[model samples]
Target: MSRSIDYGNLMHRAMRGLIQEVLADVADNGLPGNHHFFITFDTTHEDARLADWLRDRYPREMTVVLQHWFDNLVVGDDGFGISLNFGDSPERLFIPYDSILTFVDPSVEFGLRFETQDQESEAEDAEASPPLRARRDEPETEAEADAAGDEDEAQDAEVVQLDKFRK
Candidate 1:
């Protein structure tokens, strides 16, 4: 058998498309009850441009929540832009699709992990390739899955910016 097809890459691209679709829908109709997103991306990716302060803080990777306090959320073909509050201050973040590492909607226990071309091609050995986790249809609680690790990590990457929206 020949390994001519790059199904893995195709799958990753399709998943990114799904993300764009979901965000586009949210942009158009608003998030339907209880549904939110936890998006983790590589900060150093060439296409990723974060606030200087944010870049300094999350030098490697960062996760953002799309629940309540984000504005001007625009999802485009190559990347996305959203305004979030940081330390009660508003900041805009632009992340390219290729920079994303993981996207999880703990509300529904749906998650997708990605392996970028740069990342996959960097390793000299195939064993070093990132494992692709199959999506589980089962719905679980945020406390159980904890996709982004702990509340501290979530707080560290506080892209939800709820303070400004809070009274």
Candidate 2:
């Protein structure tokens, strides 16, 4: 039996490690300059933990922004925990690295996306395109900024896909 290397999974691990490092730095020194994250994760993942209402609202997936007001960001080897305000109510969440589907920093026009086995199979049959870039227009109000951080930008941002590195 021939054993083939799982390059895709290897790349995923590397990318997740990168996220861990970045979050670790942010946890120690806070987000630098305009760098902030728009992280989308699978709420249904067994290791994911969010408020009951949050899970109810975002049954399958949820996106959270790490910007001005988040608190208690603790990055662990396997996951991270954070407290964010939802309608003025602070909610804590624990998100496993494997559950993350997308991580984007619109300020830098950088992003990484991980596809699930199901999504990967579906992607194999469809034409590919770069991930949507989040808009960076300055928000007019604090309320707008908070809400806007979750919105996707119109312009195309450069996303590094692991598949491109495979032979």
Candidate 3:
């Protein structure tokens, strides 16, 4: 049998949760002693933004290093905003949670592949989630589902954010 899901809005929120969790961790604990991030995002993706010159320069994907010199690591509900040095010139960027294509941290053997806003998030969600757990597809009680949903959201966030982006 075939079934369909409405992952359109869900994916974006899921993506947001992922970014929020990791960023919260970093903010709370201070990068975990050399655990930095190399996040590559779609420069032109709608919710994403970059210095005008930088955008003109790299229209597609740009990899940023989260190191000591970096500044302004702010995470919003929808995405993140930060500034990176692109050859001595500090460039500010706005990356929508949905526009992130890949997140990697070789330190922990971790990486995350963010589905494209249009067609990917749902695809990955269905592929990654185990069939057994979600098979029932029943309406869960508010209290039960609320607790479960929060946990599920966290796990889902971890799976998607801390996944292998290239491999």
Candidate 4:
């Protein structure tokens, strides 16, 4: 199979731009009016994590919501960090740059899309970057635990709204 196209970099730039947009908003307007983000990514994708048990639980893909009551939001050349609320508790997370895959903020009807290789890749490793391109934690539920046990990493048990895409 041969085709003349740059779909690889195309998708990469698109995702990069998408992330830049969100970052731009945060940089310029400062997370306007309760407008936060929900990011999902793979834990073992190089720079993502969850609580020990949480990671041991949901090993595949994990998602976390960033809104009010979060703490220690640190953005770096690689990934980001924040403190989010989990099941009746609070947990701090450090998401790497290469782990993030999907980022969405339904409040303003905005979302960022990142293209991965397979079902395993898109398994929700949410964090951070590369040219060939890139980039979770927690299984607060059984599915999370099953996924976590599937991989060996520092995952967490953060909270994310998995029902936004449903109608």
TM-score leader: 2
| Best model number under lDDT | 2
Which pairs in model 3 have colliding backbones?
A: 111-163
User: Mind giving the per-residue lDDT tens digits that candidate 3 earns over 1-167?
Assistant: 99788664565466558667998667566687767776778887877877778787777877776767667778777777877787888878777776776666656646565555344456466665421121122222336546665454323433466466767
Q: lDDT of all the models against the reference?
A: 0.79, 0.83, 0.64, 0.63
How does candidate 3 fare on TM-score? 0.61
Q: Candidate 1: which stretches are off by over 4 Å?
A: 1-3, 117-131, 137-167
Candidates 1 and 3 compared: the better one by TM-score is 1
lDDT of 1 at 90: 85
Worst 10 residues of 1 by lDDT: 148-157
How would you order the candidates by TM-score, starting with the best? 2, 1, 3, 4
Q: Which one wins by lDDT: 1 or 3?
A: 1
